[model samples]
Target: MTLTLRQPSMLTGMDIPSATQPTPEPAIHVRGLEKSYKDLRVLRGVDLDVARGSIVALLGSNGAGKTTMVRILATLLRADAGTARVNSLDVATRAADVRASISLTGQFAAVDEILTGRENLVLIARLRHLKDPGGIADDLLARFSLTEAGGRRVGTYSGGMRRRLDIAMSLIGNPPVVFLDEPTTGLDPQARLEVWQAVRELAAGGTTVLLTTQYLDEAEQLADRIAILHEGRIVVDGTLGELRRLLPPATVEYVEKQPTLEDVFLTLVGAGTEQGQR
Candidate 1:
C-alpha cells in the first residue's frame, strides 16, 4: 500500500516558526531503497516517508529485512541501490550529516556495566563534546527516572534500568531522529511500558522516531503510522484503521466477556510506575 501524507507540521508546543509559513521537511525520506548481500536481495525498491515528530513503526516477521533497512537508514550499513535522506541530507553522500541528525538503539542495550549509570551518560556526553556533560547527564538521569539509581554501578542495575540508560545515552545530543530496533525485546511488561512512555515523550518533544518491532500490540499502542515489511518490501503502510479496512469484514459475534492473559498478567504485576518501580 502506498503511504501518502500531508506536508509535515511541527508538533504542538515545539519552538518553531509559525505553521502558517512553509511546512517543514520530512524527518526521513526514502525512495526506491534497496539492499542485498552476496547475491541475496534483502530489500526491493522500498519507498517510505516519515513525518517530523511522528512515531512510525516498521513491523515484520523474521528475516523480513527490517533490521537491514534500519541499519541502512542509521548509516551503519550502506544500501546497494536507491536513495535515502535524513533531514534532507543524503545518506550516501552526506553520511556524517545524517549521523549528526540521528541516533540509533539496537535490539540489545548498549551500556557499560563496569561504570555507574551516571558515569556512562557523562562519558557519552563528553564524547559528544557537549559544553556541560555533567549537567546533561544529570538531567537525562532525572528525565528517565534513573536519578535514584544513577550513582549505582551499572552491573547492579536491573535490565529495565540498563535499557533506560542506553536510551538516555542515545538522546545525549538530542538528535532530531532516533531509530529503535526491537527496544522492548526481552523486557518485562512493566519495563516495556516504561520504554513506551519514554518513546511517547520523545515524539511529544518533537523528535522523530522510527522503530522496528515484532509485536503487533506494540505497533498498535505506540505507532502513529505502521508499515509492514514483507518479501523485501513494504507490503502495507498506513494508519491502523486504514490497514484494518484492507482486511475482510470481521464476523461479529456476541459472547460473554472474558479476561485476557494480558489482563491477568497486568493484574498480577500491578500498575508499576513508568520508572519501573515495583
Candidate 2:
C-alpha cells in the first residue's frame, strides 16, 4: 500500500496548555521502567509520558516488550524496576487504585459469544458495580453503532462488531486511562478502521490512550505522539512530524501511481457500515 505520512487532527482537549495555565500532569508516566523473566530482560529502563486526552502509539517489533509495558501500566504485572503511574496513581504502590482508574483491552476480543451485544455490555457494567447497567448498555450500543445488533448473539456478529462491543464494555466505569495492546492485531482493514474510529472517539471524550501496535500507518493515522520501543527501551518518542524529520527529505520522483492492495481490495469489496452485516 502507498502509505503517505499525513498529520492526523488532534483530539479534543489535547491542545497545548497556555503559558498562563499550569500544564496538567500526563495521564500516564513512566521512569526507568524495567522488567525481565529469569535471565531474559524484557524491558530496560524505559521512559514515556502520554498526555491526557491524547492517543500515544507505542510502536515496536514482535517481542519488543510492548505487551510487557502495557501489562505493568495496567497493573496486571509487577515491574522489577522504575516507577510508573496512571492518572497520578502509582502502578506499583497503589495497584488497586491504578486498576480502578484504567482499563486494559488485550489483543483479542474478550466478549462472550453466547451473549448478545447488549447483554455483554450490561454484564460488564454490573461487574463494575455501576447503576443502570441496562441504560449504560443502550448508550454504548448507540455510541458504537451497535444498537441494531444489540439483540443478536455476538457469535453472529462480524469481527469489527465484536471488537467494538469489547471496547464499549471496557468503558463501563469511564476510566480515565486506557491501554490497548495491539487492538487491531488480527483484524482486516475494515475492522482496523472501525477500531481506529472507536479509539478516536475515546480521545474526544477526554480519555487518555496508550496504544501499542507494530503497524506504522496505524500510529501515523491515530497518535498525537509516537514512541518506538526497541530492545526493551524507547528508542524514539515524538510527534509524527518530529519522527519524519529524523530521516532526510524524500526524493521527488515521478512514477505511475498504482493502487495498493488495500485500495483495490477495499474498492472491490467496498466499506461496510458499523453493523458489519454478519
Candidate 2, 116-152: lDDT as tens digits: 9999998988887777888888888887889989999
Clashes of 2: 0
Worst 10 residues of 1 by lDDT: 1-10
Candidate lDDT scores, in order, read: 0.84, 0.85
TM-score of each: 0.90, 0.90
Q: How do the residues 1-278 of candidate 1 rate in per-residue lDDT, one tens digit apiece?
A: 11122212212224332255356667899999989999889999999999878899999998899999999999899998999988778899989878877889998898999999999999988887777788888888888889888888888887788888899888877777899999899998878888899898887777789999999999999999999999899998999999999989888999999998878898987747545342
Cα RMSD for predicted model 1: 4.8
Residue 27 in model 2: shift from native, Å? Answer: 0.5
Cα lDDT for residue 118, candidate 2: 93
What is the clash count for each candidate, in the order shown?
0, 0
- The segments of candidate 1 whose C-alpha lies over 4 angstroms from its true place after superposition are 1-21, 274-278
